[model samples]
Target: MRTCPHPFASLVLLITLSAAAQPPTSPLGPVSPTTGLVLRDDAVRALIQESSGDRIHDGVQRLALIARDTQSGYTEAAAWTKTAAEAAGLQDVRLEPMKDGPQWRATRGELWVAGAHRYRVTSYADLPMSLAAGSGAFEGADVELVDVGTGTQEAEYAGKDLKGKVALTRGPPVAALRNAVVKRGAVGVVSSYSTPPWNLSHRMDGDFPDQVGWGLVPRSLSTPGVPAPFLFMISDRQGRELLAQLRAGPVKVDVSIATQTDTGHLSIVSGVIPGTRAGEELVLTAHLDHYKPGADDNASGSATLLELVRTYTTLIRRGVLPPPVRTLRVLWLPEFEGTREWFSLHGEEPVRRVAQFNFDMLGASLTRAHSRFQVSYTPDWNGSFVNAVSESTLAFMNRFNSVVYPPRKDFRIGSVTGSQDPMDAHMERYGRGSDHQLFNDHGIPGVAFSTWPDDGYHTSGDRPENVDPTQLHRAAFAGLASITVAAWAEGAGALELARLVALHGVRRVAEDEFRARRDLTSVPVAELPETYRLTRAAVRIAYQREREALRSCLSLGAPAAPVQAMAKALESAEAQALGRLEVDGKARGASLREASPSAAERQARTFVPRRVKGQELASFDELARKAAPEQQPRVAAVQAAITAAETALRERGEGELRFYQLPDALASYADGKRSVADIRDAAYAEYGHVFPVDALVELFGLLEQGGVMTRIR
Candidate 1:
């Protein structure tokens, strides 16, 4: 028997008992100061208690049985989700069909190695990820297996004959196909690209094989010169065995794949909980597509969303929770491609979306999955008060649980799952892997609630058993609380959000100041002026970004009074933060100049950067084609940097390189109204500390040369 550590636990228990004994009421009480909405700790506690991890497990178990795509499996999963939403008592539950490009469906696939030692490699019937999505049908044929280590690089295949043979690699399936099959004429590929916390082999007890999530052989590569090859994913242990056989002597593999491809509709399951305001909406979304047994990758997210719908509907129907002022919309998409199709079909309707919350891989057990929940926000340019609200809600939950449960390592008395520790979560910056990227691309402020470092992510090992019910409840609670606050926030709530933005602004400025000061040491005394100019530009842009965030609150119908109050608060905070910089400057024996526009600003004011008419978004190829002979080398360098960074991002499965790319940032900020200098300043504010000025200049120069941007005087 465990004893409560604090008197607060007894108080909390008394409160819980008292609340449980009382009857449900409309508009649940205890309004939060941060969100200007009723938090209803009692209701939240009840919902959490009622939440079934077993239900989540069951849902994941069902979804994980098939690979959800445009095939029959996808249709089945969509129907099931729609039914689940309907069963949850959600209104207007329906499957929205999206017309998309070619849909690849694996009907059958098999691989067997028959050289040095005979062994079966994989079977699609057993593990869908083994076949690597998009593989075309092929008759069983024996071919020599040649080892191409990390087959993504050309150097890796130098002096090796890959013709009429199978390329074996430790690289990703996609990369191996591109390098070995498309370029070198390999008939097939065997890859073993493991998930992150790469030290899993050292940490975990056995030889664990990882799933190759999905692989694609582009149509463009299937021309007369390059034949699309069948790609098979094998475990690291199996791949090692093949490599050992190859080192000892020649190894041969027999491969066969039978797949179906056709123009099909990607299913999107969606429904709405109507609010008083007709058009305003808060979207709760999660992708429902992945390899078979992709429990953590997306089944968890889908289950969590369903549970949220159930909880919200139950509470609203029972009159224990008030319907939001703005409608709450739920979407289960087939990952990125499906999201893109949905947006294309809806077109401008996204403009009415106030906020979007995406759930992906959210049910990982802290102990079993080796994961932690992360509340990731939009970029600084797209920042809103939502970040503050969500972070604060999560912080409050952590504090509340700490007091109520006390400290215990094994488990909590009332906790439904194994772990006894309080919910551990932290705020994360912008990331670009899931469906949220599409929303953010369309100017809708979106956040992703997910867990990271799961060894079984995108692998066969990600089963229903790895998901913790308590974590599911916690995730559902955090997501619900944030959405509810955003949906119901009135003028006062909007004002609170503004205050948070101001606070965020203060922190951003302080961080920039600290970074700028630290950077000063790395530069020569003669270069201080340039560095100072850049730092000042960053500070001004930071304030402008905050101002933009506060202004966006108006879109949510926040009253003028609150907006004005926010402005005043932001002004005070900015002044105080800048004041400290001056003191620090004096102490460092350097006279810091007041934040002001630089010579670049003056030059930029003379010209506006406008988008070219009827031109597509700039790509590396377009930039190269548009560059002059002399500028081609510099253009190539920029392209190389971006490609290398993206490749590193894919291989590591960690870091913010995906979000920090300068080309995308420049493209996003380069509107006709903003000058070149303004765009540069905004980029500096967002990512200037990490990227050098020369690199930025070159990227902007390429964009200008590529006609993606034209300077009009």
Candidate 2:
């Protein structure tokens, strides 16, 4: 038998080791060079000291009390947040409403096994997530609940009599409802489906077995003559139990949903910390809508924004920090839809939206959730000085919260009444699935601060208890510091930040060269020529990419002379790196040569796609729903291509580009100047995925047909 050590043994060992550990005794000099950030360290520190985890937690707990959607609940939450912002002394605090048309709201809902045993399956009163969004009303007592396993196919219901009954399925609510409710005449659906574990590491049924999923039924009910019915989400464990009970005999359950589908406007809650400059500002945003108890998925992010407002406002008012040179504005809105609506209405406002720092999920307990705080910077193709600044700020927080043996920094930070868990944070290339997508899609660079692989994401497990107050404090500190640094990027600090952009630009370009060279040198001789072609293309495109990134520094009010110089240096760097590649190819008996464009590539090169004056690519879901009847087939084909591209890229271990990011990446490069071929090459270089030229041609063709873009011969 194995013996257990005392629980205090590790603590005692750590103390003993600390006493005997050899070191320079005193703190060492900086292990790394100082980050060229124009941070107001004193002000940032004051804000950090003033930030309240408890207050943030209170905000989250309060917001999570309402099952917020794009309906009345969202309006209520917005009103509360608006009041809080005003009370915190933030100027220009108000709720701006944007109509999203009619939306669904569930008032009372419950599903229970109504036999002798009286087993309660779920109730919206107890857990709001149990009621899926867009679910219609269905009141019935002891309706026969038939187990139709994955009832998404006709074959699953061939022999089942679901007429006037309820379907218990392990498939998506929409798909199951279409088959069981629409085709087989079922009255409602009980779905216990979770996305496959491989795609989302933590959203597996095995991980959170009792988590009632949050999902949506189709809003339009676009199918002709199909009745809109109710949808109830039960846990995977409850679903399994129901399935097991079905093995013995049939089950009868009572289903009641008092829901309403009504017109409501999506609203945005806005507050600002005043600045010296009138027309320039940095935007911080978080989505405020999710199911009840949606703590980490975004109540945490929204609550943190409130805390930032309080801390920054109080600090500035107390003379702890000077007013910003550029205004700092924060927004709480419905995810995606609200952002798109806001920008559409205010796209040409005189106020320049310089940059964005979007907080999405910031309060996951790192240890419990097996999650790490991630700063997803701007994409490589869309790289900016903001990334370097964010990196520097994250580094500062890491050192500030660490338990270094001999301390690199002279100070450390931890909440006295909160967790002491080490801050696990890292930086990665751009990722989609947040409000920042809107900023990056429209030529503005943005960064999204979040936690990933959250097991409870989009489920009932995303409760307030799962959120850590300490994590909120750290995230708030890092985000506030980063945005402040960017806001104050002028004078000497701006020069340093500009230099940092140049340095990071060089490294980014060099990284592409490094990867290409490694692959070129190792490939067989017959494949060497083709590899060299792609290698050379990567190096050339990297220079252009980094050059574009360097230009973003000018948005910080940095001097144009230095930024232009840095851009010129990128060309020089590319030449040097390409020259080295030539030497390697020469030694390998492969001559450096550009591959002639194939017929398809040449054809693609002839057509230039331009945005339709001022239109961003509509989301695929919206396009599918709104497309004319004749365009339905085309929409389906385009979606298939997107799925195929993402699948192929994933199979090749490519993660930089995700499925949802394809349209945005394409839109980013389609500036009316770059041909389809040029855009494809640049996108390939940025993401390391070789999307076929034909795919680009077809996508652009579809976009043109949709009136979002136009093709010039």
Candidate 3:
């Protein structure tokens, strides 16, 4: 009789064996598998159609129409694409506009320009906090002017509220003072100088969604550490002379600006690249439109995907790319608004999508990028195919153009934190500021791509001239490797079952009894239905946390040390999640009453053991005969994870570092050292959400103290 390898057990063995073979590495979580499970053409094709973006050929024609006189947005872009659609044998072509920013505000005060109305809010007092205050530091005292340089210190602001008069403070050298000014609320501050001021410098947090780092500060970019704000570098000595003039007399001006919300026509563009296979699906996508003129901003990717339509189709026609395993659906969304609408329209469709490959800003120099071949993956994909199912889809980027363009080199990708133990992750999400968000929110595997270290992001200079072809090639090739292959090493049932299990883990598709039972031929245990599948994954993850906490409590052995504090923190967290504090005297409570002892006692206790301590474990069929009908499979799964964790805790070194900090892309984006554009490119590189670089670093610090992981350095 055939028997299946234990799913949870196999996962344990994989982790155990891999760690034994590796050496010390970075703290950036474990690197993951770069390839995806290969599927048959029919299955893959269905998934593709359910995914991918629109296929437009003859870029020159599409561009020609876009460059036409009447083009304001995607509406005209789509209307002109009729001929291209017909040539591609597709009928519908849409040009949809995505509305973003009005909902997004610049957290920092903006520097707007109009012919004669040019004013610069040089200090933090110019932001919203000060916006409501109306007057700039209008204190009622005799104004004594002090050129304290940039007031970036508690000390600079020490002992005085320099109000009612110009408090000549220096621009910040190290710490940013935008927030400090809100508290200081000085009369008026004299900013000695500034570089070519960024109109969007003070951006609303929401506008920059991905966690791209601003970048590592070039040593020569400015003076070493911004000492006192007075010493910080600014534009010119002329501005300094002007500041000296301000101290000569009283300067007062009325400050007034009106802000209102307006209604405008909003749209989202969507197109498709069909596949021969009808059932399974794969999605290829990229945002064709942006808030600013983004040729390299996205023109590089725009041109790239337009070219991919030709490349993939040509491969199919020549039988080189092979028939897709699923139907491919290509989408050129207008970003945020388009995603919201698409989901609203088709949220209920139960299409089996193999994966979603999202390509965003994919043009930049490969050699200069922060995370070479780095791709940010969402934490869910292939419902049952994956164990942790933490990845939306497998996201991989070529190390350099060389990784994809052959002379074919091995794409050496690094975790945002690569200096750790066994490399099991790409740590891309640390840099997840991009377009893959909709899919992740919708519960699909989303992998995004962009060249890390986005030097030309959002500024006027991020033009077509700065675009790089190799970056596009790396992203496209990496995406194809993970989503488009075939051959069922685990068999069709495993493929299907794995997908089912993964989905079941996430609460997407429900598990059907018939299918689970049909595959029972290889089962060493009884078949499970949806109810059992869910209970297991949640409880397993839950107990893993609980067990670690309990062990921390035990290790401290005594009650109030750091170890004990950690144990208590975990215990408190576990109790909140489960609805009851499992403290000594309070095991049973109203919130988490179901899993209590009384609850367990109420349900009949059935013990149909799968494995014995001495002999080979009994099969599910045999256990069923001896077992009572009351035992729940979920209860069994929880007990299983707990038992496993306890075993590991005994042998211990440090726990999995992945649990602590974010991936390398994120780390690069985080402010301690790496650059911002690098982090932004990570999500674009991997096709995922973009997080703020500075905030994530703080989070990494918190995780280190929690004992889930230790910083590698």
Candidate 4:
């Protein structure tokens, strides 16, 4: 490693330059570039240098060889993690059992186009994802291949003879199974569906034509007497070739699959380093389970987690860093189900959880994936100092990892064995669909680091070769640094955190107010009143969350003076922003007077909905099955609304809430204290979308009707 004789001066100057770019009162997040929190300069630099991309890359390569898909592969991966954690000097490393999850493992599978000549498309031996999980056993069954585009709707299957034939569709495999196999007696399905393209710039098939996607047919979708349908996922190019052959002549396809299903427990691997504080903890989490060869989708994250354990433990043992004040725990688990189970265990220990950092899909090569590394800050409703810490770390990584013009000798933060690729990293607003959601839903704030426009996510192209070592090194450095700063927070460090929270709060308020102004300016006069109400709710709700974030500093043993001073400054900033919003509204011919809630909103205020323990809605399919007969139509309607909203948002390529995420957002606020009106308001503030009160009221009513929830009078 090269020596930077005076790097601290360069580090400080970088922060000063970044702050100067913004207003003095609202600097981005933290004072120092590294770790965001106030900590020893020497320790921060050492942590950065200690992160090894080669070590992380080796771990990723090893883990990618395991078919870790929440079953046999997941169990095997858990054992490996347990042993590795112990070797890294972590205490109390164990594999915890999460019970009652569906389990299935592939034995042998292959798909071939058969006739006078045989052409093998794929096999489980070559790509495990080619054989969808939960597929039934079949032996060399030859069936006619029918081309039913999408294969999800009756229209797609119209006038097609699918009986005992294998259906080929570019839609979800599960949906194809339900509509074509279960309902219409198809033998199986060959799907080529990948995640929808992000935009015109990032088309999955155009970029990675040979990528075979991962798919599954859930056991719940099985018919009573009918055999379970097997599904095979082929690449888009292969699928298109099959379609062309079908147009020319009748096509015969041979499919074989052998799988076993058992009711077994999912696994969670947890490793901890004890601290002076007993129950208070900071957790670093990454899902260790995905398909085989899933390097960037999750193996990268899990590998980086292992590296953090090794680096931190080694540093503390070598007397290079101080022992943490709070307990630090690292978790590798199956994505959603395992996360929920982990939180359910320990009798809901959310109050003791100070913060969490989540890593997922962190090793993409910028040039290969055309993706950017994103730090998704905590949701607005559960605001905390963690967001500030994350923002600061992100800024540091962006500046240090990228090539600066007239590169200075004083600034050196590069891995020796890793590529010195300029990083495309920045902060993103709250995003869903990762292990971090469970923590946020439990009222504990967390942040997720990920790469977006992942070209091969859930596809065969997410192989070890697709991962970049430099990206892994940068992510590990930033992630470990963020957690370390929080773990060691005390008097002076806590004070700095307090100031950072206030500084970040002012910037957020400004951003929110600016968005609201744009919305108000565009609204038609007829809809101005309703739009103005939403705008007011958005800005005020944001200010309240900022206050809550400031208050969170007291838990870090921060002195009352800094906390109070920052709170006052936060108040002043919000007040100024609100005044500007008022002027904008008045100029647009909207009244600034406080307006009462509409009848629907007022009625919503009366019902305080609480989720039934252990019965919260987990998926839309589960809700459809569990809802009462009369409520089925309503549940379907609500789900349809969510889908429509999600499509609209995605088509426009903006907003934070995905259709699938709306339920969790609503559930996060349903703590028996917030009225339906309050939940609606919070949702509006968080995503800038006004969910209809009728839709929310109907959804909860159906849940209550199904014994999944109870509404207080």
Better of 1 and 3 by lDDT: 1
Give the alpha carbon lDDT tens digit for every residue of 167-212 in model 4.
9998778788888888888888999887653332365353566888
Deviation (Å) of 180 in candidate 4: 1.8
The number of clashing residue pairs in each candidate reads: 0, 0, 131, 0
Model 3, 1-713: lDDT tens digits are 99998999999999988975564221111122332233333332333332222221123224422321112444454444434444543324565544433321122222221123334433222222222112211212233444555566667666765543335443432232332333544333333323112212323222332211111111222223321111112223423543565566543333223322223444544455554545556666766554233444465555545555555555455444444435666666556556666666555577656556677666554433222334663442112122222232332221222232323233332222112111122324322345564564344556666554444454333444344443444344445444443111122322332332232233321222222222222222222222123232333333332333223222111233433344345445444533321231132222312233233222211211111111111122233234334543433443343334333432343222111212322322232222232323232222222233333333333323322223323
Report, for every candidate in turn, its global Cα lDDT versus the true structure: 0.69, 0.76, 0.37, 0.78
> lDDT per residue, candidate 1, 516-599, as tens digits?
556554555555655655666666555666777777777766677767776667667666655654454455565445345556
TM-score of 1: 0.83
Per-candidate Cα RMSD to the true structure, in Å, reads 7.3, 10.0, 22.3, 6.9
- Prediction 4 TM-score vs. true: 0.90
lDDT, ranked from best to worst: 4, 2, 1, 3
Candidate 2, residues 1-713, lDDT tens digits: the string is 99888879988988988865533111111123443335544444465678877778888899999878647778888899899888888899978989758777778998989889997788888987788887877788989989888887778888889999999998777888878877778888898986633435345555678877777778554354554788889888999999998999988999888887777687889888987778998999999988888898799999889888887777666655667778998899889888988887778888887889999999888878778888987865676778877777777777667653315332344554557787658887666878888888776789999887677877788888888888888888778777766776665556667777676666667778888788788878876776777778888977776677677767766688988988887777788999999888889976556567788788888989887766774654555567788877767776776677777767777543244557656666777888988777776666665667776787788777777788777
- Model 1 residue 100 lDDT? 57
Model 3 weakest lDDT span, ten residues long: 607-616
A best-first ranking of the candidates according to their TM-score comes to 4, 2, 1, 3
2 or 3, greater by TM-score: 2
Between the candidate structures 1 and 3, which one is better when assessed by TM-score?
1
lDDT of model 1, residue 235: 78
